[model samples]
Target: MDESYFVGWGTLMLINAVLAQGKNRSGLNWFLLSLLLGPVATFFLALSEKK
Candidate 1:
């Protein structure tokens, strides 16, 4: 259960990175941010306008 939790978190980080890139933002920066913010990062990315 703990292992799956980590896997899911890691996956979310990568997805957030890609999503940020789609918004013309920095992927690596968002990846690191998502490591701390998780789903909140997804919400921010979702609401952000594409540059």
Candidate 2:
């Protein structure tokens, strides 16, 4: 049960990294931020200006 949750979180982190790269943002930074903010990070990423 707990394992699945972490797996999902890790998956989101990877996806966020990809998305961040597409937006010309730092994937490592966004991945770390997503570790803390989770879905909120994705939301902010969506609202952020793309390069």
Candidate 3:
């Protein structure tokens, strides 16, 4: 359980870092949202980027 939690959080942080590398506004928004919302929010933000 603990390992899985760490892996999940680590993955989310990696994805958030990638997402936060381009535009300043979106990057800041994603970084803040990732902290507040976690993996599910990361998934949602990634999906929303497609549209």
RMSD of each: 1.0, 1.0, 3.4
- Per-candidate TM-score against the hidden true structure: 0.94, 0.93, 0.50
What overall lDDT, based on C-alpha atoms, would model 3 receive against the true structure?
Answer: 0.67
Name model 1 segments beyond 4 Å from true: none
lDDT of 3 by residue, 1-51 (tens): 679987877678667866756423366567667776887777776665432
Best by TM-score: 1
For candidate 2, write residues 1-51 as lDDT tens digits.
689999999999999999999999999999999999999999999899998
lDDT of each: 0.96, 0.96, 0.67
Query: How far out, in Å, is residue 31 in model 1?
Result: 0.2
What range of 10 consecutive residues in model 2 has the weakest lDDT sum? 1-10
Give stretches of model 3 more than 4 Å off: 1-11, 20-25
The reply for model 2, stretches above 4 Å from the true place, is none
List the lowest-lDDT window of 10 residues for candidate 1: 16-25
lDDT (Cα, 0-100) at 29 in candidate 2: 100
As a whole number from 0 to 100, the lDDT of residue 31 in candidate 3 is 63
lDDT of 3 at 5: 82
Candidate 2 local Cα displacement, residue 26, angstroms = 0.3
Name the lDDT of candidate 2.
0.96
